[model samples]
Target: MQGHGYAQPVKQPPHIAWLVFLRVLFVVIGIFSIGFLTWAMMLRLAIVTRKSLDWGVFVAVLAANILSLVLLATEPGDEIHTAGGNLGITLLLGTLVAAIAYYLAADIRHFHRLHDAFTAHRSMAPAYGYPAAPSPYTATTVPSVPHTPPPMPHTPLSQPPIPAPPQRPAPARIDQVRAELDELSDYLRKQDGHHDGHHEGGR
Candidate 1:
């Protein structure tokens, strides 16, 4: 085991972006340990290592953020308003970053798969005399018949026709109406006369 001197180089310490990713990630674990551990003073508080303290600080930061938001939302005028607000922002961004990281990790696998598929397709095209790939959704088939039409025909939209307004009822006559009114008045007068005749009959 000692004969082989070719130990793998510590995968070139992560670049700036990677470091940022790590630090951003560091918060997830940092809140639990790194936050406090980063400070030299905390080393003497307990038997905690530098690494462990940072994690606590990071976690404590998250907790503090959560606490501040809760306090701010519940009691707006709380003395720790500034601290709570800052923590709230940190918590939100950190949580978002974490979620994005989760998605990135998940999608990386798909990206790798696509890469492999592309390579495989390219490798096979020369062997089969197949046409070059255009895109994933594009059709690769060549024309079979002399006059092959487009896959789908173009057509204008068939909008529902607006209905015509209904015909209005015929207008009533003014002279006839007046005559009917007169007839009604006469009928009312006869009813009154009948009532009077009844009174006379009773007498």
Candidate 2:
């Protein structure tokens, strides 16, 4: 599907002044050790730039600040009297500040690099808010001829007649069977009577 012929405006890179302001803010907050606020700002910058080194520096500074605070609170009486423990705590606080400054510098450099790349990309992209040119070749449709299928061979509807099955003989009636049995019994009785007459004559 074709989109509406209007081109969309290109998005410009973020202003360099904003990044500078963030760096200044990060440095100030790091000097004061403003709890998690410094950590939050540093983390935000790291996330925006997708720079792991920036985040690592922030974490180191945060740890140093916390350690310094702990040392200040837990110093023993003798340790407080001695200059060595006090000097160590001071160094820790200084290290934290230095780490913060380093991270801010790295972040500013990253922003500049990002802005340069983005500007280059935008320059290379096609101009926005303009309609695309029409293609040189125009599409012409050829009229399609309606196709007719070839006629099939005609088959005769009449089939060969099937042969009829052979007929079975009919069964005998019950009255015929009973008449045959009666005839057989009459013959047996005549034979027995003849034998009895012969026996009486002999006696």
Candidate 3:
């Protein structure tokens, strides 16, 4: 029987932790009347990562931080104000802190997702110092022939013998042809003489 198998945990890049810490640090710094810095960092990160940025949220946070700073700086020392400026400063500071914290949490989540993507890409890449993978065209195994074939014997090719020219007719056959021609001429001459004698008698 086979034992249960467990999947290995995925590895993450080290920079992701640093990114999270930096974002959290910015949030902490923003608590000291400078929450606009956190918003600006969020906007920069969003642009770098091609993530969406809520401009409305950024404007509101910046405005609240600036107004809170102004109110605190202008407050008269130890004087009770009827304008409810204390409550107003408290509300603005609360809004700024909450917005900065929310953005920091979002940035952390974005960093994690980015890290996961980087991890997946790195895992798929070829490992260092390993032999290259065989090409797909050469992946199939083929058996090598054990013996070298002997070179084929180089035999000279044979050609047909050319025939000799036909022999000329013999001298004896040439004489016979001349004799037959002479006899034919004599017979023609006798026939012509007999025809002339018969024509003279009739005249």
**Which candidate comes out best when scored by TM-score?**
2
RMSD of each predicted structure:
32.3, 19.4, 14.2
- Candidate 2 accuracy as TM-score: 0.47
What lDDT does candidate 2 reach at residue 120?
60
Per-residue lDDT of candidate 3, residues 1-203 (tens digit): 98544334445645756776867666676666444454565554556456445555666666766776667667676563735557556756677667776676776676678677767655655453334457998787787779989999999889899999999999999999999999999999999999999999999
Residues 1-203 of candidate 1 have per-residue lDDT tens digits of 56634322222222346544644553454345423222222222122223454456445545554553564565355453576555654554564455344334533443455556666766775576655546868765867668777798889999999999997655567667788999999999999999999999999
Prediction 3 TM-score vs. true: 0.44
Q: Point out the worst 10-residue segment of candidate 2 by lDDT.
A: 125-134
Q: Rate the local accuracy (lDDT) of all candidates.
A: 0.51, 0.66, 0.67
Tens digit per residue, CA lDDT, model 2, 1-203? 99767544435557778767867776777667534244655676667767677678668756765676666667677456545558547756667556666666667677677677767656654565444444758544767689999899999899899999986554565567777888888888888898999999999
Residue pairs with backbone overlap in model 2:
none
All candidates' TM-scores? Answer: 0.23, 0.47, 0.44
lDDT of 3: 0.67
Candidate 1, superposed: residue stretches over 4 Å from native = 1-75, 78-94, 129-203
Ranking by lDDT: 3, 2, 1
Model 3 spans > 4 angstroms off:
1-14, 34-50, 70-80, 124-203
